[model samples]
Target: MTIPALEQIHRHASVRHYTPEPVSDDLLERIVRAAQAASTSSNLQSWSVVAVRNEATRQHLAELCGGQRHVAAAPLFLAFCADRARLDRACQLAGLSQDASTLESFLVSALDAVIAAQNAALAAESLGLGICYIGGIRNRPLEVIDLLKLPAKVFPIVGMTIGWPARPLRQRPRLPLHSVLHHETYHPIRDEDLLAYDQTMRATGIYKDPEKGWLARSAQRVQNPERPHLAEAIRQQGFALK
Candidate 1:
């Protein structure tokens, strides 16, 4: 079974170790062009990206990302941003407000940024480059804002480290499709399915603590509020998040 569309992302894994090879500017420009081709909500295109290559700046960014060494070591780092700055300018030009305070607007911008980032990641992978998406970039959003020197109404949703892999990628198995896909409206996963997945996790050695099941971890995660200050950070970036 050859899936042509998926060949670009086949067995994709986040590569932490990388060689010192530098990603060229021409290659980066081509990747960005592919990213720009991604569709946006109502064509609002409320997204932007900042490519960082300076070692010193990357060191600061790596610290902001909670000491992720890969951020600084990678040949290229990109910050995918939700940018309402352009929308604001458009509003000013039209003498109309886009009501950027709404939660819907915020979600749209964030989704747009994420969608574009995915496109860029795929493009990079197709070119034999490794990429690691750094969610820790949000650990200290305020600092990232200052380090990146982003204008008002612009914030990095995620950071990506891109370079040539130093070693082979470790491919992790994904959950079965039945657990996610539905036949009709909606359906809850059966308990037996979780138990089976737990066994699979243990057999696959994917987790350090294989005794801990995904269902249990998910239950605890939903209750535990991660990144409680994200709303305030988003607000500081000029989004209302209403």
Candidate 2:
């Protein structure tokens, strides 16, 4: 019963290795247009994307993104930003006061950015392009902002690298349906479900050690003390987040 679109979705894998072939300007524009076609909260469309094609800029950004080489190697890198600057300007032009400093406003803008990015990613994948989300950009938000020349009321949500794949990648294993799907009310995940998912992940052989499964790896990531200072960075970027 799986449709072609669903099959593509299920086959998605993060592509870190890319070929030297460049993505054409027209294709990049089309992909971005598809992103703009995504649903926006209240039709405000409070998001912006900065396309980085320069090798020097991409290298600097790659370093800022915790030395992720794929960012520098990709044909194109896009920085999706949760933007309120345009809305604020619109309010000013209408002789109205702007109040986009609240936490709710920030959340809405960030959500819009995420939705747009997904749409763009799907469009790229449909066109036989590869994409990888680079969340490490958040590790040095101020540096990214300075490098991109982002104004106040605009905060980078995430960065994505897109290009032609160097080689095919296998789909990563995911948790079972029952572990995440809850009908009517929230249900606590059973330990057995987690163990089963861990086994599946181990069997995939992606990790160096099969014994260190998804649960342990995920828990380690969650407990990592080297988390990004996103809240402080957001505050500095003029988001009150109240």
Candidate 3:
């Protein structure tokens, strides 16, 4: 049976255009509270969010985020960061040795940030606000870190833009259920499944050229090798990744 929450989840679409109206601080707090309610690893809650409302900062961030104008146009932009600095401080206060510099530490913090961001996104959507995740921020991690004044053990995981939608948005198509949901032991992806999904994507007309389907687009994206310096950047930010 379809519930209201399920309906909302299924209706989700990335909103690139937004109205000029600003999101009230009271409402933004509530949305963030909802995000804090998301499950965290070992209750560590190793994540932080920076709310960017300043016009100039947003404009600079938009430029850093691969020139996405929607980022600057949005009423609010949130930078979700994977943070272990707080935990390290806590450990030091207790006179204990802290070593949150490993790869596992980075992974856990990133996962926590991602989960919290999704919670915030859903909450915003429920309140009739539009939201878009900005992974493009990773393209210039060092710049973002400097702009935000992030600490040694904290790094940007992703960014989000939120505001009231200027117009209706069409839901994007997803991969077939069989391809994602595997039963028993891991099932190998069938070629037919990919071909069928590619055809479905072409039919949906999300792409301008129907000939350029999911497979081609996804392959092109991976082959482009964007953000090659990301790993080195993270290491410089104090993540051992070992």
Candidate 4:
């Protein structure tokens, strides 16, 4: 027998199409409590979520997120943020300043936000809702920060689109178990693994064929400095990359 949460995780899919129903405040609070339950580093939970329900704001955010229609269409759009503002406040209360300028500080806060978002997503899924993560918010980081009115020590890390699914859920194949799940020692991924997964993806008929497969596409994303302004934007958000 499958555990309830495990079953939910296994059936996870990014939902794009959504019905026109709004998520109730009660449901939102429940999912937020689930997010709070996520473990944080050193008990310093440096993350916050901004829930967007306003129409005009959601429209502007959708544009900022590279015109992802689901962001605008979803009943709720949640922006998960890497936030050290609370820590800064805590330090201020103790008459001390937060030295949260290191790269590690940014990493910890980003990871915390991501983990919390995953918990909230799972909770919403268990409650018969759908979700899609939007990494495109990084495309125009400065604009997003301005529009969201985030404090100096805060930055949007990810956005989640939530609503009831209007269409069938499409579950894409993940990398092979052995390719990702290594043994005691770190193992290098073999070329065959990529090819096999590429072949499996082609069978799905979801993604249009590119000139190259997964590895090539992955490399292209890395090679492209499309979000060149992101690092500077993060620095402007008070994370000193020095």
Order of all candidates by lDDT, from best down to worst? 3, 2, 4, 1
Instruction: For residue 94, give model 4's deviation from the true position in Å.
Output: 1.5
* Candidate lDDT (C-alpha), each: 0.88, 0.92, 0.93, 0.91
Off-target runs (Cα >4 Å) in candidate 2 are: 1-3, 225-228
Candidate 1 vs candidate 2: which has greater TM-score? 2
TM-score of each: 0.91, 0.96, 0.96, 0.94
Per-residue lDDT of candidate 4, residues 1-242 (tens digit): 33487788998999999999999999999999999999998879999999999999999999999998989999899999999999998999999999988999999999999999999999998888999999998989889989999999899999999999999899989999999888999999998988998877777777677556666667877995677788899998899966
Instruction: Please give the distance, in angstroms, between residue 30's alpha carbon in candidate 2 and its true position after superposition.
Output: 0.8
Root mean square deviation (Cα) for candidate 1? 2.4
In model 2, state the lDDT of residue 47. 99
Q: On a 0 to 1 TM-score scale, where does candidate 3 land against the true structure? A: 0.96
How many angstroms is residue 197 displaced in model 3 relative to the true structure, after the best TM-score fit?
1.3
Off by more than 4 A, model 4: 1-3, 210-216
Tens-digit lDDT track of model 3 for 86-179 = 9988898999967876799999999999999999999999889999999988989999999999989899999999999999887888878888
- Over 1-242, each residue of candidate 1 has an lDDT whose tens digit, in order, gives 33355876775899999898999999999889888999999998999999999999999999989899999999999999999999888998999976788888888999999999999998888888999999988999999998889998898899999999999888866667898999977889888878787677667666677767666677886887889989999998888878
Which 10 consecutive positions of candidate 1 have the poorest summed lDDT? 1-10
